[model samples]
Target: MAGSVNQQQAVIYCRVSGAKQVREGDGLASQETRCREYAKYKGYCVLDVFTDDMTGKAASRPGMQSMLGYLHMNASKGSEIVVIIDDISRLARGLTAHLELRQSLAGAGGKLESPSIEFGEDSDSVLVENLLASVAQHQREKNGEQTSNRMKGRMMNGYSVFCAPVGYRYEKTAGHGKLLVRDEPAASIIRKAMEGFASGRFETMAEVKRYLESQPAFPNIDGSIRQQVVTDLFSRVLYAGYIEHEPWGITRRKGHHEALVSLETFERIQARKAERNLAPARTDINADFPLRGAVACADCDAPMTSCWSKSATGKRYPYFWCQTKTCGMYRKSIRAEKIDAAFAEVMHALSPAKGLVGLVKTMLHDAWGQRLAQANTIKETTKRDIAQLDKQLDGLLDRVVESDNPTVLW
Candidate 1:
């Protein structure tokens, strides 16, 4: 009877609430130790141990999954395998997961075992197990709710919660969990930009972009500060020493971190925004004359617009006209042919002379030759590295033949 009992092979399964718990505490290790002791008392041979460092509430766990796959393999046929756990809750947290995992193991022909509870065929035992699983799930959810409440309390006390914005970086202090700190050059640069805008030095966001482009330290995407980034930067209230996150019901609370600009300056910027918002939308220029604003009216020296005019015979024609009301040529159409011909003549005359073109080509060829020399140097360096790597590989292969360890060859 004892010899037959020793034939029963078992795999131990253990779980913790989180990976942190696994590292800080011996939750997984302790569970395995207890499970192995129980398996030994039952005259069982322990084949493997599976440890999960994640929530037991989920149906999926890496270790548990691997153990299941190994136990259910074709080679394990005709052998009675038991999945031994310290407790049923170690297998799962919620009632759903507990029942699901139980059924799954049964389908895989794995007998469930624990030091605490006996695997029963009766309905009462199953009901007790489900109740225990429900308790574990409730505990897990309660802990999560408390953690969220703590974070919300911290936010309500006026500490920044999310990842730091562009001009700021998150720092950990002795008293504070996490707080924002001004990140250099970028912070000073942003502060200067904000002050410039508020003081009317930068009239538009476009002007601010031009200022940023002139700066060597401004963060840019593909060597350019995006217009939308500049526009979005103007609306951040954190620059004014306040936080305004609406999701947590927070609105303009004073943050612990330093401000880039004063609240009054921020308000003035907002006023400028509101004032611009009230302006009437500009009508789009006619695509018939794409160069209306770009090309000046030759007669009045003002920008020219284009429109179609209908003759008495009902024939329509497009012509360029001036937009200035005070000018004598205002609304007076210039023949489209005349404007088109002038533009073409200007463009043609702007090309470099033949001698200057040859000089530019020579300069370009000299630059190309320098780049070619750099490429050849890089190629030689790459070839040397490859040759060294090949020698190392050959030496390792020779050692592997002499070494007894199969892993050396591998």
Candidate 2:
């Protein structure tokens, strides 16, 4: 039995909550080292190391799942497996997760060993581990509640509890959160949008979208301006210089960030929105056009909007016309029937020749094979670069600290 236990395979599990915790020097690395030492003392062969830089409120961690899967795969081979952790809290922050993991490991004929605690298949040891886990969970909940209450008190005292909105930025003064106005190109577009609504230049939300898309200063997160973002910008009261926590319907005092538009301008924009909402809906006959915004007017470069009209004789005709009124070209509305025919003709022209198609397929297959080889080479190079950068950063920091000059040290 002692020989069998000595030949068992094991895996080390280490976790830290944040990258800052890892940098503090007594974290994941330290945990891994301690677990390795523990495994050596127990005479078990260490198979792998799994590290997760995440909170242990639950056990749905990637590293934890991989370790468990490895154990299950080796269980039927008569291979005994052990999971080693630095402490119980490192395994989980709550009792439920602890109890569930304990049962799971036991069911798989595996064991969990921690530097601070040991859990086995015995009833007495399991009871003690559960009790300790419960105490740790209770303390965690209490600390979380206290921190939330403190934050609430700070917010009520006119301190911002969250980061500043997109148009504004946070200014940390004496380690306290404060709001500051930052003028960005997006600010000009926001101001223009408000002005357009105020002066009746934009009649509806769609009109506002078109106007915004034409502006050079519009904000885009990833090369696309989503419709929801436009709607939120027009509806938010914060841009008008007032702050409201909508969940509680509580309006606070005016924010410290500079207002993008005057209150009067904002009010006028709201009035226009109300007017547009109350107006009777006009018939839009060309609503079925799929490429409505994709096509552009050849004369003025504005998007070509499709529309349909019914004559007195009950015949409906669809047409695409230019949007810009300033364009001097007098090309009449092109019939939708004619445009469809032209598109079909272009598609027919692109039908590949039989010989050309075969050659192109062969070329594509060869190119793909070369691309896979190149990708593998690049991946290996990137791994080496990352390892070198990590070592370089560590050495540079050490050298900087050893400098004699106080200014450089600071």
Instruction: Please tell me which predicted candidate would have the highest TM-score against the true structure.
Output: 2
Per-residue lDDT of 308-343 in model 1, one digit per residue for the tens?
A: 779999998878776666778877778887877888
Across residues 1-410, which tens digit of lDDT does each residue of candidate 2 receive? 13354487778889887677877758888899999899889888887888888777786888878877777886654555888999888888799887787777656656789778877658998788888888878877887789777756665554545656556556665545555555455565677677765654444566666566665445565445667766777776667766666453355656555788887887777775665232112223124454444556777765555667688999999776664557664344777777777777887889787799889989999977755665665567569889999999999899897888778766
Best by lDDT: 1
Q: Mark the 10 consecutive residues where model 1 has the least summed lDDT.
A: 277-286
lDDT score of model 2? 0.69
**Cα error, candidate 1, residue 305 (Å):** 20
Report lDDT (CA) for all predictions. 0.76, 0.69
